[model samples]
Target: MGGERGSIVHRITKRVSQEIEEDPNLVLINKKNADQADYLIGGGITSFDTYIDREKKDNRKYCTKGVFVSIRYQLVDVKTKEIVYTEERYIDRQDTREGSAPHAIAVVSDDIDMLAKQIVDITRPHEVKVTERIYLVETKNKDFKTACKLAKKSENRRKAQELFAKVYADEGSYQTGYNSAVLLFLNRDFEKAMEEMQAIEEKFHTKEAQKALKRIQEEIEYQQKPVQETSLDSMYLRF
Candidate 1:
């Protein structure tokens, strides 16, 4: 798990172990119990990059920061010693702010849950049917109204995300800010979503945002770990 960022591998492994278990067919086992499991998931960071920029705006300094990470990993059938699935996943995130940049450690946080869930999606042999919905927020602004409509279309959601961001920036209201962050969370941009949610709480201190922020943070934490963990046996975490 050791790589450019000393602790990143550990974080990614923990996230991956927690997420991959979401697949109904798979249960993580301690790597020490390799003989007891049917498959294994392993990976490591291939490349990582970080950058920051600052701009002076109306006597205030605004900072923009970004992180890029690439990871290579594989899923192997334990008994057959065959590579079942493998991929080199690339993820990059940029945050432009009107003030201080996000913390250095926080900036480097990549969503390994995305990579792990991607693997689960690809490896899952069967599909389970489930119902879900993406809700829209109410806004008097015409642009916000348009965004609500655009969001209903799956592919147009990024466009909607941009609009939502604009509404949040312009209004700076709790409702707009909350909706913006919620959309990012739904889009799986956990880190940025967290940043936005925290901002809402800081500015409005509303109970609704506080509760939503807690739920978002908990999800980002993966129940503080997987639903089930076998301490002595070791859960399927590999780096």
Candidate 2:
């Protein structure tokens, strides 16, 4: 895999591997890990087309480039030797760009990323507990109250996160800020979490917030993957 087409092969493997590993029910392994990988995902470019529309106006040349790429990939159950899942994903991008070839290539990678996420969604999903401390401090902030209620159930945690973020914005207390960052971390929004943690450190300079920042950094180092899928599941009852 050396030519333009070959460039997509590595992207497909990498994107798919990362998304599949995010599933709490699956473990990702390669030559470096133990020989326990139970599924094989593979495929190639199913179809693609690229075109550059150029026009001359007054003396300057205008270019509107377009790219359409489709790739077909699959997940094969290794033990029983069966093709459990397969999908065809297509990406189209068109705009004036510095180069047409690179645009087309990037479109392929983007399409592969979308495909990988859909595969992750369809994989045998099992929810896992992610340990996080939500601040239940008595607050006048309505968002805080709503977050506490929503966080009681695992399925509502994502929505709870949005409210927690609002609480942090309204009241920049350490507890509020930490709660907000943990929600972002739980949702696997590491970049946003990092930003929020940095803000917390700058404002409060507290040790607890710093430690939370360190945990977030470790997760980023682990390839934007969660170290574990611990949950706030039913823990609100204890409080």
Tens digits of per-residue lDDT for model 1, 1-239: 24336566666666666676655566767656778777666656678787889999799888988878777665566676655444467778777777778753465564655555665554453441111233355657988888778766555666777887897788776666676787676565778988998997999897777887886776666423422321112234222
- The models' CA-based lDDT, in order, is 0.64, 0.63
TM-score of 1: 0.47
User: What is the Cα-based lDDT of residue 157 in candidate 1?
Assistant: 62
TM-score of each: 0.47, 0.44
Alpha-carbon deviation at 110 in model 1, angstroms: 7.2
Superposed by TM-score, candidate 2 places the C-alpha of residue 11 at a distance from the truth, in angstroms, of 2.0
Global lDDT of model 1:
0.64
